[model samples]
Each structure stands twice: as C-alpha cells, then as structure tokens.
Target chain A: MGHNGKMIRKKDLTFLQKSYIPEILKGMRQTIAEMFKPKFTFRYPEERFRPNPSFRGRPVLVQENEVERCVACGLCSRVCPALAIEVQASETELEKERYPIKFEINMVRCIFCGFCEEVCPEEAIVMSNEYELVFSSQEEALFGKDRLLKSAEELKPRLEFLRLNR
Target chain B: MQSLLLISALKFVAFVAVVLLTVIMLVYAERRVSAFIQNRLGPNRVGPWGLLQAIVDVVKLLLKEDVVPRNAYKPVHDLAPIISIAVALSTFAIIPFGNTINVYGHEVKLMIADVNVGILYLLSITSLGVYGVTLAGWSSNNKYSLLGGLRSSAQMISYELSMGLSIIGVLMVSGTLRLDQIVLQQTKYLWGWMPAWNFLLQPVAFITFVVAAFAETNRLPFDLPEAEPELVGGYHTEYSGLKFGLFFLAEYANMITAGAVITTLFLGGWHLPFAENLGLSPLMLSLLQVLTFCVKMFFVMMFFIVVRWTIPRFRYDQLMNIGWKLMLPLTLVNVLVTGLVLLLIQ
Candidate 1:
C-alpha cells in the first residue's frame, strides 16, 4: 500500500554523471564529519554502567514461614512454552489445601520467560536479580525443592536487613 | 639448505608471535572501542583494563570440548578455520612496518619480507581467504551456513573487482606498485601548500577504494556473511573451540590488513605530511612519519569499529547489487576520469 502511493521521480544520471564523482564527494564528506563527531564508545573496566531495572533474570521460589506460597496451581506447567517447569500437586496436611510435592525446574530448558512467575496464584515463584546461575553439569541444573528452599533461606538475612533499614 | 632453513625458522617464529600478539590486542581494542561507543565499561577483571582477558578466553576455549555436529563433514569443518587464519596471517609478510635499523653487525628491516610484487601478493592471498569462509559454509551441511558462504563469496567477488580497479588508479598516479615508492611520492607538497597525497588528486578513487575495502573486509553494513539474525551463526554455525577462535583471529587480521593497505595507498604509507619540504632532520622526519602512519592506521581501525556499531547490515541482494551494479561501474568511470584529467593537465 505504501509503495503504490509514492510516485518519486528518480534522476537518471549517466555512466559518469551518476556514479563516480558524486559518490566520492558524498563519502568523503560523511567520513570527515564522522571523524570530528563525538565517538559513540564507552571505555569499559575503568567505567561501568547499570543494566535496566526490569531486566528478567533467574527464577527463585519464595517461602512463607515454614511453608511455600505455592499451592501448586499447575498454571506455570501449562503456560511454559519450553516445557521446562514441572510441578505436581498433592493434598497437604493443612486444612483443604494442596501443594506441589514434586517441583523441578530444568535451567537448561528454561527460556527465562517469566510466565511461570505470572501464572503462580500465591506468588510463590519470582525471578531474582541473580542471573549468574551456570552449572557445569545438566544434572545440577535440574533444581529441586531443596535447592529453591535453600536459596530462600540464604536470601533471608539480606531481605530482612533491607526491610528493617527501610 | 641449512642457512635457508635457519632463516625460515626464525621468520616463522617471529611471524607467529606478531600475529598472535596483534590479534589479542586488537580484540581488546575492539572491546574497548565498542564499550566506549555504547557508553558502558568493557572487561576489567582478568588484568588492568582486562588486558589479560583474551588470554583467559583462549584458555577457556582450549579446555572446551570441540563439538562437531553429527551431520557435519569432518574434513571441511576442521580445514575451514585453519585456512581462514593461515591466509589472513600470510598477508603480513609484504607489509613494511618500519624502516631499516642497524643490528650488531647487519642491517635489518623490521618487516618480515619485502616482495617486489607486494601489492599483488597481498591481493591474491586475501582473495584466498574467501575460499575458507565459503568452503566452511558449504561443507557444513547446514542451510544457514551454506547461504552465508554463498552470500560471502558473491559479495567478496563483486567488491574484489572494484577494490582492485580503485587501486589501479592509485598505482597509475604513483607509477609504482612498491609501497615504499608510493609513500615517497606523497612526501612532497603540491605548490608548497597541499599535501601531495593521492587522496587529493584521486579523491574519487579513494572513496571507491575505502567503500570497496569495507566490503572486501566483510565489515558492518557489508557484513552479510555473518548476519546473525538470518544466518544464525553463519558459516561457522557448526564450529566450536579453537576452530572458532581462528576464524575470529582471521577477521581482526583482515581489518589490520585493510587498514595497512589504505594507509599505504591513499594516506601516504608511513610518510609524514610535508616531510620532504620541512626543515626537520632525516632521522627525526622518519620517526615522525612512522608515528603519523601509526596514528592514521589507528584512526582507520576506529572507523571500522564505529561504523560496525552505527550502520545496519545490508540485505544480501542489496549488498551484491551495490557491489556489482554500482561500485564496479563507478570505479571504472573513476579510472577513465582520472586518466583523462592527468593527460589533459599534462
């Protein structure tokens, strides 16, 4: 549609008139201007810059007292495009409650989509800012409940310190 | 045979050292330049300003498992990158880096070798580099790699014609293919005011040369060979480890070679502006000229990096069409016009 509307008259320059002389001048002028213009480079190492605030990183599981916030809704397992997340729900000891008995996330398969976080009704799963989670083996990346729970425990002191200071 | 063997061995060691050091530093420079352009700090952890980062990366790659895809041709997969790196390094032979210096008892030129047909040698060797890339892509048995190889070969062949033609104009004006002679020609001022560089007399040729050089080097805007979005990993999609590193080294070496050629041809190879007419001493002038050449080369290298960040890649068809249909015809016209002007003025 856009192509049909525009009727542009193109100047037909001859062999010499069109090609040689004009392109030479245009290119030179462009390069000369560029030489003087402020260079678009940042000296790294000595200087550093921050990443965007909302940058999505690795996913983390949240803890509420002794229990997890996840009621094992199974929304994440259904919505995950990569099929990386696994959650199995079973009736818990608490009143009329269900929770994930077997929850495993394969980091290798996970695309960091944040869909899992969005699908969690209890807000049990959240993506943390710690993006540097590389495992040497595939087995290590298959994060089970124990690892997630351990991470939550590790983050407790820092979270509380921030909360109290604020 | 023994003496020849000794000389060859010495030359090989020197050449290997230079190529490795230059590639490492060039990688660091590229990182720093890109970082500065993007307004971000680049590498800094391994050593001061991350000077040792390339080494660390090399070690990491060495330990990495060299993975060849199951369907890939083993022979071509291994041969491609080695050929790429070898051809790129071979061009360094004929480039005269610095003037002769007196050793303990003998005179030595800093350059490794000075072939009389240095320009032709460089062009031919550089042309062979395309074969490595093309073969790598073709033999990979991957669709994307094959497409990339095809695009690279076509683009390179098209631009190669123009690049050679553009330089013919410079060769005509200087009346010599010897790089040293060309630089000498540009040392004198025209009417004691203008620098007697080819850039002034044959500016048309210079532009064509620079643009075509960019294409030949597979730089941005013309970097259709490894257009990441469409070609995925391009010709080296199936390559990994040191094989991949060799390709990376070859690229930087090509950049250096292009910069050196441009300096030698248009910007007065290692010759200071108005050096001949100026009252400076011979030694002082030589030193100044070398420094000038280095500065010019540095600026050209910076231009390569800056342009890479600024411009978007050209479509495959657009790249080919521009090279063959536009640059080729224009360069031919440039030669004709330059010849006419020289004849008329005479």
Candidate 2:
C-alpha cells in the first residue's frame, strides 16, 4: 500500500464487503443461529462427568487379595516428578517378602502425571478414577495406605485397559 | 396543580424504577445471549435460568471494597460515574413511552418530560456522556485510561455528526421537534397500506442512525474507547467495586436509552399495526400501546447485545475513517434526498 497509492492487495473486496453492513448482518445471522444450538456445559453440582478407563486421575496402589501389590522398590517414588510418594520397606511374612509399611502419597503435590504408575515394575500403582481429591490441610493431603490403596475388583477397567494396551 | 404534581411524581417514580430494572435485566440478557452464541451456559445457578444473576452481581459489587488510587484526583473519580449514569438516564425524559392515557379522568402523558425540543436535548445530553468517561480516565492518572478517554471523546465527536444528520432526515419528514408529535406523525398510513415508520420512509437515515447509535453506545465495532486488549478496560481501568459497577450500569443504561430512542424515532413508537381496529376500549388500547413500545425496545436491545458478540472492535484509524469518510457523507446525502423528496411531494 506504500507504493504511491498503487494497490498492493492481492484481492479487492467487493462493493458489499467494502460497505460491510451485509457482511455484518451475515455474521449476526450465524451467531443468532448458533444461539439456538445445544450448549456444552455441565451443571457441576447436579451433574458429574465420568472419565474413561484410559483417563488417568488420582494414583492409588492396587490391592490384590487384601494385600497391596507394591514391592516397596521405591521406583514410583523415584519416578514421581512431584516427589509426592513416600515408601518405607519392611520384611513381611507374605510371598512378596517386602511391602511398604509407611506408604503415603501427598495429594497436594501429586500432579496426576501418571509417571509413577508407568514406572512401577509390578503394576502395583495405577491411576484410579476417584479424581475428587479435596484436602483441608497439607497434613490431611498426605494420603496414607488407607486412602491410597484400592481393591483390584474396583479398578478392573483400568487394569483391563493396562493389560489390553501394555 | 396538585393533581398535576401528583401524576408527575408517580410517572417519575415509575420511569426510574423501570429503567433501573431494565438495566439489570439487560446485563443478564447480554451474558446469557453471549453464552448462547458461544455454545456455553452462563450463570444458570443464581436463580431460575439466572434471572436474578444481575441483581446478585449488583449486591456483590456493593459489598466489595471501593478502592481509590493514592495519586488519583479523588473528587472527579467519584463524580464521573455519577455523571455517566445521570446522562444515560436523563435522555429518557423526553422519550414518549405511549400516547396520552386517561387515568381517573385526567389525561396523563406517558413520558417523564414532554420537552418541545426533544431531539436537541437528546443530542446535547448524550454527547455529554463522553465527559464521564474522559474525566474518569483523566482523574485516574493512568496513561491507558487517558488514551481510552481521548479515543472515546474523538469517537463520539466524529459519529455524533452523522447521528444528528441522520435524525435531520426524520425531522424533515415529520416536521416537528417534539418526540411525541414526531411519533404521532408516524401513525399515518402511507398509500393506505404501509405504516409510515421513519425507517420505511427514509431507509438510508434508519441505517445510518442505527450504526451511529451503535458507535455512540461504545458497543463493539466502535468500542475503541475501552478496547480491553490495548487500553485495559479503557477509562474504567482504575475503578473498582461499586464505582466500577456504576460505570457498568451506565453502559447498559445508555444501551436501553439508545434502544428507546431508536424505537421512538424510526420504529413508529407505540403504533401497533391495526390494533386500533380491534374494537378495544381507549384505556385498553393505551395499555397495549405501552406494551407495544416496550416490546419494540426489547427487540432493539436484543439487536444491540447480539451485534456486540457478532462483530469485533474497530481499530482507531478504521473507526475514524468510517465516522468521517463513510457515515458522515452517507447521512448528508440521505438528508438532501429526504428534503428534495419532501419538497417534491408538497
């Protein structure tokens, strides 16, 4: 446009486009039509979202036959990017021989990255579907085995999903 | 004289109450409409379909801290929003909501004030609305606010000319300055079929006037004054709590005034098509006429809200170009043609 009033535009707008009123009316028509269409919003309190099996929510230790599948190898703690998991190994009479006696996952620091679940040698830790993790204090957010462990039957879909994919 | 005073007081109370309520409702409608356009549900939790959201929002604003900048000129900052809301509300005084209605054997005009020079009052008062924005910007000692104030004043000046010229065509067609008389003139049927609305009679004037109205109201496609990306809330950058709430109410109030003005001038104010021939009583007809006026204003207000979300803000240069180059000349031509046509018809 700087070439001494010579036109540099590749395409010239039509009279209607230059006037812009018709184009504006057209846009208004589109918007008004869109108003009658369905809205994509969840009424959060009354309605809830159900995530898929592939969805990684909160991380929990898988429990099999009333015992945790974790071998207390500290691989999940080592792999946790947020440093949310803490594990203390103690010899047990069970066949797994070693289990986490002081197993805790800080809900506040857990970023839901699923890295800890991926790094576990024994499919012991897996992301669960229970995503509504509300904590009043930092101490309250440090989830112990009581809160972090889920039964194998309860997490069957995610386990099945892991089996099918991996 | 006592009865006259009583009726006037009643009308004043009713008008102010309706305007304020409509302002709150307009805010809710804007949010809901914008959400609908974008495929999202907005503010449905406040009340049934979020009907009470705007009222709740006003309460929230009232409860918030009224903050003032340490270096700010405090007096003008306080007075600016008052000026804005006052100007926005006062323009409605001359707008005739309906024809004269008989109440207890007394003829009561449905307007707050029946000023003879209604159009002039409207033009002068609406232009003064810029002072509120300008003073708010200037008093804040914020550069963005200052720029916003400057842009709004310039924008108002440029568009106000076209807005006035567009109305001149309507004035020539109707040949009266009293808004009620103008509305009365529009009640006639042209060629015994078409209702002689100013819009139908002078199409060009209607288009130019509506566009000018959009710009004057500081809505989108001309909201360069408060362009959020560039000016950060524009003149209201420093205002918070109830102070900011007043500006918000003023914006929506200005919108309703514009809608009412547009309806009164161009849309055949309160002249419901063929409603007179329905064998209704005069009192019933007057009531219907009032309702008709409200429905027309509501539709126009809807147009304003929909247009806001439909169009993007104009650049400062583009705004100036349109104001000076396009709308000004267009309205001038429309005025000339209207005058010539009137002369020929006479």
Question: Evaluated with DockQ, which candidate comes out highest?
Answer: 2
The candidate maximizing lDDT is 2
Clashes of each: 8, 0
Candidate 2 Cα misplacement greater than 4 A, ranges? A1-11, A93-95
Tens-digit lDDT string for candidate 1 (B237-298):
87888888888889988888888888878887777655556897756666776678778888
lDDT of 1 by residue, A44-149 (tens): 4454433333545667777767787778888988999999889999998885399889889999999988888767776677666556677999999999988765
> Lowest summed lDDT over 10 consecutive residues: which window, candidate 1 chain A?
A44-53
Which residue pairs in candidate 1 collide? Answer: A40-B37, A41-B36, A41-B37, A42-B35, A42-B36, A42-B37, A44-B41, A44-B42
TM-scores for all candidates: the values are: 0.69, 0.95
Shift in Å, residue A126, candidate 1: 17
Q: What DockQ would you assign to candidate 1?
A: 0.13
Interface root-mean-square deviation (Å) of every model:
5.8, 0.6
For candidate 1, please provide the TM-score of chain A on its own: 0.59
